[model samples]
Each structure stands twice: as C-alpha cells, then as structure tokens.
Target chain A: MIRALISRIKQGYRTYPFPKKEPVLPERFNGRPVLNHDKCDNCRACEKACPTGAITSQDNKVCIDMGKCLFCGDCTSACPKGVIEFSKDYRLAANIRKDLLVSDKEIKLAQAIDKQSRRIFGRSLKLRQVSAGGCNACEADTNVLTTLTFDLGRFGIQFVASPRHADGILVTGPVTENMRLALKKTYDAIPSPKFVIAVGACAISGGPYIGHTETSNGANGIVPVDLYIPGCPPHPYTILDGLVTFLGRR
Target chain B: MSRQLISIYNNKSTDIGAVPNLPIDDFRETVINSVNTGRRIAAFFGLPHDNDSLKLIIVLADDHQSILHLASTCVKEKYPSLTPDCPQAHWFEREIAEQFGIRPEGHPWLKPIRFHHSYTNNDVWNRSANETILPCVTDFFRVEGSEIHEVAVGPVHAGIIEPGHFRFQCNGENVLHLEISLGYQHRGIERQMTTAPQNRLIHYMETAAGDTTIGHTMAHCYIFEGLASCSAAARAQVLRGIALELERLANHTGDLGALAGDVGYLPTSSFCGRIRGDFLNMTAILCGNRFGRNFMRPGGTAYDIEKSHIDDLRKRLNAALKDVTNAANCLWSTPSVLGRFEDTGILNKQICSQLGIVGPPARACGFDRDCRYNFPSGIFQFKQMPVATWDSGDVFARAYVRWLEIQHSVAFILDLLDSIPAGNIQNKISAMSPCKIAVSLVEGWRGEICHVAVTDNSGKLARYKIVDPSFHNWMGLAVALRNQQISDFPLCNKSFNLSYCGHDL
Candidate 1:
C-alpha cells in the first residue's frame, strides 16, 4: 500500500487541460493538410501519388478529402513545388460531410449541436463505441480518451457499454459486411434524439479499404452520422475536440 | 527421392520456379514430418490455379536452422487434411477451405474461418450464392448434461475492443471448453491485397493490425524490398529497428497495465496506462502518428530523426523507461496482483507447441521461439535481443515475459539511438522481378508477423498472405480456458491480448 501511494505521488497528475489550453503536439505530427493551388504546376503528381485517391484534380485544381486521406504525406513527398503540406493543426472534425472536402480553403470545422440537443447532451454525453471493422488503432485512441491523461469523464463524455445507456453512438471502422447488421442494430438500440459520430478515416470513407467488396466503405450509408472525426486513426485530442464542439461545451 | 521443400532465407526472394511443387501425398507427408521434427508452419494458404485446380503453398520455419522451407501442391478439390496428423494445421486448413472451396478431408470441426464466399466455384458448406452469411452463426461444441450451461458473449463486446464471439460451456463456475468464433472483423484484406493499387498496399499493411502498425508494415516493406532486390540503408535499418522496439515497448507496457487493471489493481494500471501513452508520444516525436502509421514506407522509413532532437529523444526515453520500471515493480511487489495472476490460466508447453503459438505466450511456455533471434533480418542481423521466456506457462508468466521484453527493448533502443548509423534512409526501389516469391517475418509486439508476397508474370501481386501472431495464438487462448474458472476469462484474455481483426484479415 505504501509503495502504491509513493508511486502514485511520483506519477502526479497527468490529465492535460485542453480547450482551456492548447494541447502540445509533436512538430512532425501531420494533422490538417494545406493545399497551395497557386504553386501547382498542373503536374498532377500528388493525385497519382495519393494512396487512397484522397487528392484529385477537379478542373485542374487539387482537392483533398480528409475523409479519404490517411495523412500519409505521400502527396507532400511527390510534389515538385511543395504544393501540399500538412499543418500541425489537429482540429479536423466536421459536422457536415461537404465540409471535409478542402481545396485551398479553410475547412468549416464541426458546429455545435442544436439548442435543444446541446441542452440535453452538453452537460453529460454518454456514448457507446462500436468498432464495426476498425483495425483497433481508432478503437485504442478513442479508448485513450477515458484514460487519466485524457480524462474524457471531465468533459462529460463517457463510453457506455450498452447503447441503451448512451446519448450517441461513436462508430469506428470501414463497416464490413458481417458487421453492417450489427452496427445498424446498435444504432437502432440507442434511443431516439441520439446522434452518431463516425471516428477515423475508415468510419468516414473506408480509408484505405474503400473499394473492397467486404466493407460497406463507411458508416455514412448504414446510419446517419452527425459528426465525422478524420484521421487514419484520429489523435485522442482530435476525438475529444469533436465531442466537446458537438456538445457545445466550448 | 528429391527434396519436397525448398529452403530459403528471410527477406530473400526466391524464383517461383525454384520452389518444388510436389505431389499432394508427398507434400502432406513432408509437412507433417517437418512439423513433427519441430519446424513451425509460418504460413499455409491456397491460390487460384489454372483450370479448376487450386494450388496450396506452405512456408515452414526451421527456427533452429534460421531457414524457411517452402513447397506447393496443386489440389483439384479436396486434399488429405494435415490437421488430423499435425494439429498446428487446424486453423490454416480451415482458412484454406474457406478462401478457396478446397475441403480438408477427415478434419474435425471444419467450418468457415471468415464466412466469406469462396474464390472458386465450389463451396465447402454448400450455401447458395445469394445466401446471407453471418459471422459466429455456427454449430458450437456443447457438453449436454445437467448443470452444463453455456454462456455466449459478443460479436460486439462490452468493452471498447474489436468484435469477436466467445462461447463458454461452463459447469457452474468452472469452464469445460471455450470456443472463440471470429470473422466479424474480416474486411477481406487478403483479397484486397491481390488487387489493390500498388501505392495503397502499404496503407493496407499498416492497418493489417492497427496496434501492430510498425510490425506488419515493416514485414511488408521487407517483402517489397526483397522482391525489388533493394535493401534499406544502414541508417534506415537502424531506424526501422528502433521504431519496432518502440512499438514493442508501448504495447508491452500497455498489456502489463491492462493485466493489472483486469485484476483490480489500480496503481500500476493508471500509471502504466499514462506511461504507455508516453511511449506512444515518443514514437509520435520520431515520426508523427502515435500508432506509427505514416512512419513506414516500402524502401525505407518516411521520417528520419534529426540531430537536434536526439538529445531530447534520449531524455524522454530514459524517463519513460524509469517510469515503466517503477510501475512494473509495483505490479510485481503487490501480493494481490500476483495472487490473481499466478495460475489463473495455465497453458502447458506441449499444448502451446502443438497449437504452434508464437511470441510471448509461446515464450511463457518456454518454447524459445522469437523471430529476432531465430530469423534475424535488418538491424537484428547486426545486434540480437535475447528471447525472454518463463516456464510456468500461466497468466503470470505471460505478464512477466512482457516485463522482461520491455526492459530488453528499452536497452536495445537506447543502444541504437546512441550509435545511429550515418547514411541515407532510403534507396531507389527497383521494379519487382516477375515470377518471384518473398517471405518477411517481423517480431511484432504481439508475436511473429509473417508476410509472404508472390508476384506474377507482370510483376503484379498474385497472392499476399499475412499471418499475424494472433492467428496462431487465438487457439492457445481457447485451450488455456479448459478447466479454468469462467470469471477469470478477462484476466487470461488480457494476458494473451490477441488481435481480432488481424486474425479475421
């Protein structure tokens, strides 16, 4: 008991103060990508280099879909004039689907829920996470929010085991065929006036496994997603940011 | 008589024509004989052949000799099952039968491993084309008697973990048998591997098992490099090695913490959970993502350590290592933690060997099987890390082995960071040669991650097989539950911590 107490003291408080304060992210961390169309020589190198076909030339202009992007930086490496670069701004969540498509424009971030919805979920948001076909990275990072460092409980967002106890459903993965029914069943189990948040690239646009026959691509068609958190597997802070913003906590 | 299996080295590409395609009888006999002599089957799967035939290829690892033996045999529809003679081939044979329509005759418990449509015209289970196939909807082995009740849990578990079903036949508190039916997490990764765009292959491999990003990606990178006949530079090899160890450190620490949490021990659980994030953050510092996704590429790593950050990296690593030491020591010193862990779930060495389990679980059974020591490649070729083992083959042994590995991994990382070679991190990858086969084995934090890529006449991927450590170890988890308390499932499960999607893939 003494040893445990001493060790706890040595550990100290680990929860980071986010929203109230800026989170410390690594210099190398690739978050929201910026595209400089003016610098593009119309070479279309990045479009070819993109692994998930996230970058495309529409009317000879480059557009990147965060939902499809893995933030792999292959475009940045393939570009000649440095037309593409990922900024360390990790706020990449959005409420609307079209808002995720960025082409030399600042993305419209996730908006707060409506007045009545926020009134209900703003103070205490209980979410049930369903890893339909998640590779476990998204699941792990999402679960990290419950840890001492993230302390998602402080933000009033807890991942409940039963959908009956949740105000929303947090879905991850590409929604494989076998899991499609289960995901729909889970969403149906959550009482009405509940919302759905799709976490990670897989949950939004199938990520890398997009065109495969086994997966339904993402959760969009299966259940109506209210929020989309983007990343191959979004950082824990990114997930928390989405939750807080959607609940109108900030 | 000619040799039935062709011996090959790790990360070395062999000509497709060079691998012996023996008769089915000889192939089965050779595989059974080799496995009986202690050679582990690393990968066994089938590929579509000309006309109506299917070709079965098997890669056997001779750990002691540090060599891989490969052979192939063409089967029209069914082949004599090796699982009857060699128990290790149970899962592999079932997987082959599911992928292609080839039946392993006389095999026990034959069922759909992934519940997917067969690549060929035949269906082993004879379901119609439009039939709705669901995962975990199968006949389970039941003990019918008074007080022989059954408990079924999950395709969607109660936790934030991946989906899989567990069926336990319990007589009161004691479990008679635990049948784990998985396929819910399958996304048809192996099918996608054969047809996905070349640029997207690495991304698929990175997520093959999300937690095992570095391990699977490194294995694929090695396979790609081997096929292209290009190797990563000395510095890149060292960097890859460091990233792999960092992955090991992060995961092993997290497992120990989770094990503590399972037993209701709070101190080590909370501390190690945060410490696991610390290790992940260090990886983020090295590259970008906490999971090390974008860090790996085909020829070499995507990010390189800058000279300016070396000192800071060392400082953080040392601090995290120190924190982990204290956390693990607390776990060990606590009598309650030890009491719950000591013999909760015991898997004997013979059972582990028969099931062909690898990684820490195998090591806990004193099997002495580690890819780093047995099949050295990349940075491991220059410096080897000792294989950590324990004789108890229980939950405590699994946890203690991880603790031992965490220490060794930290020491290995520190040594590499101190003497990081000065050279280019990448080399220009040449076009892959046609009609070639290459095998890459990486010691992922979970265990041995095997990736085998076979290229066609056009240098396109014909068949790419990924054998995650979980593939071999899931059965180990099932067998361990025999005669154990049903309530202790979570603790034992965490001790193994097998991957669901990796196996489903």
Candidate 2:
C-alpha cells in the first residue's frame, strides 16, 4: 500500500487537462463520421446503411443529423471510397440543434480534399452516454474511451456521470421495449441544449436487427437525434469524430 | 427407492393403460409414472421449433439418465405440472409458463420470469396462437420470523453497477432469509434476436450478455456453423480463443478488485482495478472498442491483429502482469483482508455438485468441470492451459482460483501470440436449408454460455434461446447467502458478480 501511494504521488496529476490542451487519442480510436464527398459518388449507401436514419440523402445531397448518428463506422466500411472514413476529431459540443447537423453544402469540397492529407485530428469533447436499450457494447466502448492511452480527457472530452452536466448523449443499442421508459427518463433528465449522438448500428436504422416489433427503431424513436455513427459497434475513432463535430472543434 | 418401472412402445399411446410411444398425447400420465418410480428430476429445457410447437425435454437422472420429451401441438394448450413431483423445476416451469404461455398445470407460483405483464396478455395462452410478446411481474416470497421487517434494496445501486433487487428479512443485523429479485435490466434480447434475420443475428448475439460478448457470439456462431456444416478458419478460431481468454483475464481482475473493495481494502482494490483498466485498454487497442465489441463476427473476427499491435499488446501485458502480481502479493500480505475473506460464505462440495454449478465458483468447490478443457473448442484443443480449482468452497477459495486463472490466462495469451499463424481473419459462410437446430456451449468468464439457434426455411432465425451461466448460478447465490451474516453479503455477492442482465434475458 505504501508503495502504491508513493507511485501515485510520483505520477503527479495524471488527470487529463481538458478544455485547455488537445488530448491525445490512440491510433484506432473511432470518434465521428467524416463524409468524403469526392469519393462518395452521391450513393446513399451510408444513408441506407444507417440504422437510425441519421443520414438522409435528397437530390444527390447527403446530410447527417449529428444528433442521431452513433459513430459506429458502418458507413465508412460500406462506402466505396473509404470516403466516409472515421475522423479522430471528437470535439462534438453544440449550443443548439442547427450546429450539430452537417449538410452536403456545409462541406468545403476543396478544403476536404486538401485536409485529407493532414492526418485527421481534433480536440476531445465531453461525452455523456445513455443506454437506450443498448446491449452494453456502446457503453463499453464509451467507457474505454477514457482509458490511459486513449486518455480522451487529454483531448478535453470527459464522460460526466450525470446528464445535467453532459454536453451530449452517446446512445447505443436498438432501444429495447423495457428500456423505452428508462431512455425517456434519461433524456428528460438531461437539460436541454444537449446534443444526442447515436453510436452503433443498433442506434442507426436498428442495424440488422430493425423491424423488431419488440424494440424501438433507435434513439430517434423516443428523442431527436443529432448525429448517426454507424457500425455493428462503431469504432472508437468514429465516436471521437462525432463528438468533435458536435463541439465544432473539428 | 424404486417403485415401478414400465416401458411400453407403441405407435399410439394416449389412454391410461396405453404404452409410451410416438403419438402419446397425455403428458401428465408420463410425468406421474416417472415420479412414482422414485426417479429424481434433473432439468427441463424448452426448445421452441419453427413449426410454432414447443418441445419440452425433461431429464430424470438417478442411477441412470431417462430423457423424456413431450411434444405439444400448436393448439396453445397448457401442459401438466411437473413441479409437484420435482420441486427444483420451480424457476424453469415459471419461465416456460411465461414465455410459451404453457402453464405447468399445478405450479404453486406461476409468475413471469423475464417478460412484464404490460408486454403480454392476461390470457396469453388463449390469445393469438402465434403471439410473441410475454408479460413481466414481480412475485415476492413469504418470509417467516419475529417482527420480520423486509427491506428491499436496489434496481438502482449506490455504486455503478447493474440493477437487481434484494429483499432482506432481518431483525436489525441478524438476517433470517434473503430473497434476490432480478430482471430489472431485461431488454428482451432473446425476443429481439428471434425477429432478426440470420445474417444479422450476430449483432444480437454480441449483445445477449455484453461482458461475455465473445463467449456468447462464439457459441452463437458455433451453433450456426454446426447446423450449416461449416467451420471457422483456423486463424479465426485462434483469434477468438485469444479474445475469450483476454475477456476472462479482464473480468477476473475487475472482480478480484471489487471483492477486495467490498472487504474495505482500498489499496488492493485500486491497484487491481487499475490493472483491469490496463487490460481493458489493451482490448481497445486490439479491437478498437474495449469490452470486446465487434471482435467476433459470425465466421471469424471483425478485425485482425497487426504485427505491431501484437508487440504493443505483449509489452502492455507484461507490465500489467507485474503490477497485478505485486498488488495480489500485497493483498496476501495483509492479514486482515485474508481473514475476512478466507472462510466467509462457504458452499460445500455436496451442495455445489447437486446444484450443477459451473466455472470458477464450482471449481472452487472441487467440481472439476471447465468447458475450455473438457469440451475443447478451437485452439484450446491444441494448447496446454491449467484449469485452476480448490476444494475449500469459500470466498477466499474462489478468489484464489480466480488469481490462478488470471495467471493462466496471461500464459495462454502469450502462447497464442507466439504461435499465431498468418492467414485470413474471416471466411465466407454459405446459406443452408432451414429447420436446422444446433446447440453451442462455451466456457465464459463466469461459466458455460449455451446458445441454441433454429433457422427457418428462408434462412431466417425462427427461434434463438440463450442460456447464460448466470441463470444456472443464481441458485448458487441463494445457497451461499444462506446462514451468512448480513455484513458478509457484499463479499459473497462480489465473489460471484453474476450479471443480472445476462440472467434476466
């Protein structure tokens, strides 16, 4: 015990200095969805692949409701150009609904082309995750995001335990029937002006498990979603990007 | 104890004097005959088939095993009660009653186990014959004592943990009986999986028991592979084995820490917890998501281990081992911690074997059963890993066994990394004809995780039943809690750390 205390003392202030300096994330960390319009081919694979309908395409233009996207990375894998790749940027904090949505017109096509070579990076944003009938995979990933190496806090992203203090809700799973009440209660508990980011295939169009008469389609079934991150289980980097996009720090 | 044994084989047997045969209609008579012969009832597994019928298979194990199958038609009729003869089938009977709307004719307590009342109709059996929704209800047990004040704790705990309720019948601190009520976290994973298409079933399988993701998914995939006559690639199998072992290591470490924390050993608790965190970080590094999400796909792993990643993992693992070993050594050095845990919450070998407990808890009580070694699958068949066990059957014995297992896990991981062959991480699985039923049994961190899958003619899931280790071990908790002081409850409960969500589903 004495040795442990001594070691802890020596380590000195290991807590991430968030909101000041950008936190360092691991290599494979999945944060948020980044749309590569050049290679997108305007094919709504990502829009169709999304389980929560977080991505909607109209007239060859795609728009991501950042409030609903889960950052599961399904779109990235399904996309032919690797265009919709996961960006390390996780600063997804927003003051209002309009800020979270990313439209095709919002993309600076020329800027996106040049930025492709500049290794994707961003400051960490505080994440508040809700288990809206999730099987707990998304929760597990969100929990791991704060570990030593990933040190999401280092990126200024902190996972506040309470919804009142949260900037966004990182939702996972295909909102199960029993969890519907709990989800509503949690969303209501969180003070408004709070963004909602759906994080897994379950949260996106219910992934492959949609159409279950027993479970909800996704978080949007109960609350308005801002971003859709897609994957059977979204990669950590993708989750980081979604958070950053919400923060407007990307 | 033998009274009468009769075996009659005929094409049609329904009347009282008729022989037991294929077309037997009366299930009550068969059950009565079995009970009259002094045969002890074992277990009953409800197998739901694609034809909308139910296959209730009961086992009577005495000196020999007599398996009885009662195939009920799709007429939605209530079956005769077996609990009157076999008191142990109380939970199973209640579950089957709630799920399939097949009432155990005379079950004294026929409460719903998983589903809520709002979900299913009061006359569920008489309702639409093919209805899938079931009900959920809480049934409290009667407690007897002087001024027996029943205090209910949780559905929401003080700490960050899963939800479960405990009804403690106590006179101040002196406890009379403890009744555990779970299912608060039930998300109806089984019902959701049944509705999912075959190709997408893996998503549901991974979520069935989140912590036991790889274990459950492997079992689910194995069942599908077995039914489809397909095999995962050797590389995929080895990768899965590695992931499973890592899961076991992380959980055991976290549990050990929690156990120590329950005993008020903060130093040991923090140290072990930090080690667990490190392990979780390692998992994140390899799979991109910690707690092992998306690691195991149907035919193989979703992600492959890069050479550099393996090297990084080896480094982290070595450091973690050193730290964890040091922490455990410190814990052993503290005499108070050892004294508090040594003989607390003892479950004797006899009770353990009778209850058919599995995994570390059962191993601690001297029952030598480990699916990894006994029922070898994948690379486990080729590797040499020690199965840790102890006969003490106490809290300390369980902790010691876990400590030993963690060491074994480290060794196994190193071995796997050293011998990992270069190959494709995944393989393509072809479609197969429906009406195929396959069962998969895997040794999870807790115990055996069994998944039974049946596919329809269109290659979609007709029914999927997942039996987590926690379901079988819930009884172990009741037995362990008996006669123990209320103060020792946390220590006993943490020693098991059974997943309420896993069990409820």
Best model number under lDDT: 1
Worst 10 residues of 2 chain B by lDDT: B8-17
lDDT of 1 at A244: 91
Candidate 2 stretches with Cα past 4 Å from truth are: A1-24, A47-54, A63-72, A93-134, A137-250, B1-53, B57-76, B81-89, B106-108, B117-137, B197-199
Scored against the true structure, residue B490 in model 1 reaches a CA lDDT of: 97
Best by TM-score: 1
lDDT of 1 at A5: 95
**Native contacts recovered, in order, as a fraction for each?**
0.86, 0.16
lDDT tens string, model 1, B1-505?
Answer: 2378898999999998898999999999999999999999999989787888988999999999999999999998899999989999999999999888899998998998788888777889998778889877889999999889999998887779999989999999999999999998889888988878878888888898999999999999999999999998888899999899999999999999999999999899989989999999988987888999888787888888897667777898899988999999998999999999998799988989989999999999998899999999999999989999999999999999999999999899889888998978888899898999999999999999999989999998899999999999999999999999999999999999999999998
Candidate 2 C-alpha lDDT tens digits along A107-174: 31101112421232224334556564555556555655554434566557677766666655667767
Please give the DockQ score of every candidate, comma-separated. Answer: 0.85, 0.21
